[model samples]
Target chain A: MKTVWTQKGFLIPAGALLIAILLPIFASEYALHIAVLVLLYAYLSTAWNVLGGYAGQHSLGHSLFLGIGAYTSTFLFTKIGLTPWVGMWIGALLAGLVGWFVGYLCFRYGLKGPYFALVTIAIAEAMVSLTNNINFIGGAMGLEVKWLGNSPLLMQFESKAGYYYIALVMLVIALWLVYWLSRQRFGYHLIAVRENEDAAEALGVDTLRVKIQASILSAFLTALGGTFFAQYFTYINPRNVFGEGPSIQILLFAIVGGLGTVWGPAVGALVLVPIAELARGWLGGSFAGAHLLLYGTVMVLVMLFMPKGIIGLYESIRQRLKRGSSAPEEERTPA
Target chain B: MSMLTVSNLSRYFGGLAAVVDMSFTVEKGEIVGLIGPNGAGKTTVFNMLSGFIPPTSGEIIYQGRRMNGLKPHQICELGVTRTFQVVQPFPDMTVLENTMIGAYVRHPNTTDAKRKALETLERVDLDAKADKLGRDLTLLELKRLEIGKALASEPDLLLLDEAAAGLKDTEIEDILTLIRQLNREGMTLLIVEHLMKVIMNLSHRIIVLDFGKMIAEGTPQEISQHPAVLEAYLGKDE
Candidate 1:
């Protein structure tokens, strides 16, 4: 059973990755654009999963960190003439600091569950309002990256495929990080805290420190995604990057794909983003927010049928198959 | 040398004392039991000692160091850790994974932590359940798995909150035997339990509580015969 699981785990992700790699080669420009977008969302959702999914702290304000990353890089490039690559790191560090403060305060004060979620939402809104008034970051007018015509250092690419590969690499890196974390003692400690905080305390897992670290890592990764987003679109606005919409979208992908699983966000992005994009393309403004209606209906069905998300559905079927195949062994064992 | 010293420890939950002016000293390698009726604050005392709650006033000196305001993980780092009365296993993780978290208190590396966890599970006779998810374990296995996890931290002074609670006689004896083996290996234990037989047999000395106050402290024979203990705790049986 264990071998089969291990084999399946490796084989499935490898198979999916092989397909994702070849997609850009045969795809039309529009399809390639959508693929890049899917990879972008995958990066965001996967980064969000570090805290929101594994640590079990649902933050609807991750966009605050996203905006922080976008603005920091955009300003560094436009005003200071530094490469976006360097600016990206600086933005990530700043986001990490902010996430640390937020996590420390929330965990220290015992804000959890829905209360924590609400605070995140409020923070995102506050960032949106703050960015609108900050004249240094171009204020409400937003910042536009000048087309440098295929400079690798600028992160401004000529083709959608360049952005696609970058986004794909970033997504893969985020997945690898989450995967590494899930196998660590630190990861188990997070799960322990998630399962029962009091129990985790007695058993000697430093609940506060672990949570704060998770928040910091989460912010750092999300910021990288934000940099990717800014580079891909070549434009940044407070309302677009730092809005509540991004948070909801990220959360929907993680929750619907599978909370607490490394592959859940990737799978979620693959399933949800394509469907919504295609739905939007098909509906074509005949009925406004029709894609959201599709999302709403799909999410409700997912919640109803698989509360543990899509992964739970896959798990149960595997269990049933194993149970069915084990009848002979069970009889032989005198059960 | 004393493994732990609790001097004038008191905990008040908004004007109600849960453990009032409690003082106790546990010697190295001794199994000490805290016994009381329900709501006598046994768990409260355990909580304060393990750093789950800060004492309203007093000291928790472990291994010659002041641990009064230290957090639980810091105290565990100092070789003091605990198990809960209400068993809490990370439901999503396997038994080995659960134990690995405790082991990680000392060994941060994944390979070392897993080896330590597996050793602890073997010692607790829970190696067979290593890969089983926590929620799938039966009641007896769950309790054993709880002990397995606690032991993985390699604590010098272990606090067990009602380890023998809700067990049949045979299962209780199995746990008691395990505790005895652990104690013989030089691990000091401070257990809170209501079961008379298990506590009497496993503990070298027992402290009895009534209404958040220590009524008696003696050998099992003396505690059973103490007038206050009989009147306040065991008396209810009559």
Candidate 2:
């Protein structure tokens, strides 16, 4: 019985991967642009899930790391003629260091729940203020990637297809990383820390260390999204990357999709992003505020009815169906 | 040889001294009972010993190594594990997974940890409900699962706080029997229990405390007869 469930679990994701890989083939250019937007949000949210979802540390200021990544790569590319491919790693490392610092400072003092969330917001807000006044990295004006036509090396391309494929590949890798995390010892320790800290400590989990590591990994992954954002859009400013708006948007997908599940954030982005795009495209001037209204309504309905998100709703239905199918067989064989 | 030696252990929460100048020693293999009236600091002692709270001034020597500066996980790695008075199970996880978190301390590999956790569940008589979520268990089952989780680390010494608290006669008896079976298998224990029957029946020696101070220490029979203990504990119990 367990083996059958396991086989189905593996096969479904494999089938979905195949479908996602072929989606671009039949998609219109405009549709593919929307697909890229979905993948980008999915990638960012999945990155946020390492700490915010699995470890239960809701960092409301994750845009701090995103901004760091964007500024780091953009500065390096514009100043030294360095490629973004190399600068991205350097940005990731810096973001990881900042993540470690922030995690240690907050967790060491036992800041948690709402206090931890507030600290992240404060730190991200501080970064935005600092960036606005700084003379380097284009200051308030922002940096635009030099558009050397069809130059893949500089992370600049002539078409949206190039950016779309890059975003797709990045999302796939992030998904694979999260999938691997769900099965490992570190993952279990992380979940344990989230469930109950004192109990996890009694059971020999170093909750502080686990939280720090998750923070660093989450920050590292989020920074990659930052670099991708700068490269794909060809422009990045303080408000676009480090602002409270994008920060909320990043966590929104994770919470609405289902917090802590491997594919839930991706699932959230897939459902919400396209609706947003299609709503705006179809309704344009006729319904100026229609998409926002629709989006807000869906969020409220999910929170009210499906508090555990869509994946949780699906899981309950699946369990009921399995039990329904197996009930009669058990009675006939034993009684 | 002493497995644990605590001297002058004290904890002050602001102006209030929760535990004061308390000292005790547990030999290599013995079940020691800690009994006291409410607010007598039994849980506070356990908290300090497990490294959850830093002692204001004291020394905790476990197997001849000073444990003052160690973290909770560090203490656990040294083969001393504890269970909370308030049963804490990872509510989202299954009983087996809850035990697996403890098993992961010694067995870093997932498959090996799962195997150990399964064995622990069987020992605690919870194998039948191993797949049930932690929050779904009855109070008796939750207590047993708590013990199973602590036992999964294969600790040389275990500290149990109120393991049999708030239970029926049969449920307490079931827990008492499980503790006895574990001790017979060579697990040493330092248990803080409220039930007189549980402490007096199982302890080789008993320590009695009142208002954060130890009033008596001796064999269970001697402790039951001590005048200070009588006034401090039995008076409060009645």
Pick the TM-score winner.
Answer: 2
Tens-digit per-residue lDDT, A55-121, candidate 1: 8999989999999898888889999788999999999999999999999889899999999999989
* Cα lDDT, all candidates: 0.88, 0.91
Positional deviation of A14 in candidate 1, in angstroms?
1.7
lDDT per residue as tens, model 1, B1-238: 6778889988999989898898889999999999998999999998888888899998988888999889888888888889989888888888999889888888989999999999999988889889889989988888988888889989999999888888899889889888999999999999998888889888899998778888799999998888888888646665
- Candidate 2 local accuracy as lDDT? 0.91
How far out, in Å, is residue A252 in model 2?
0.9
Model 2: per-residue Cα lDDT over A189-291, one tens digit each: 8899999998899889999999999999999999988998899888988888999988998898888889999988998898888887888887766989988
- Misplaced by over 4 Å in model 1 are A1-8, B234-238
True contacts kept of each: 0.77, 0.84
Error of 2 at A281 (Å): 2.4
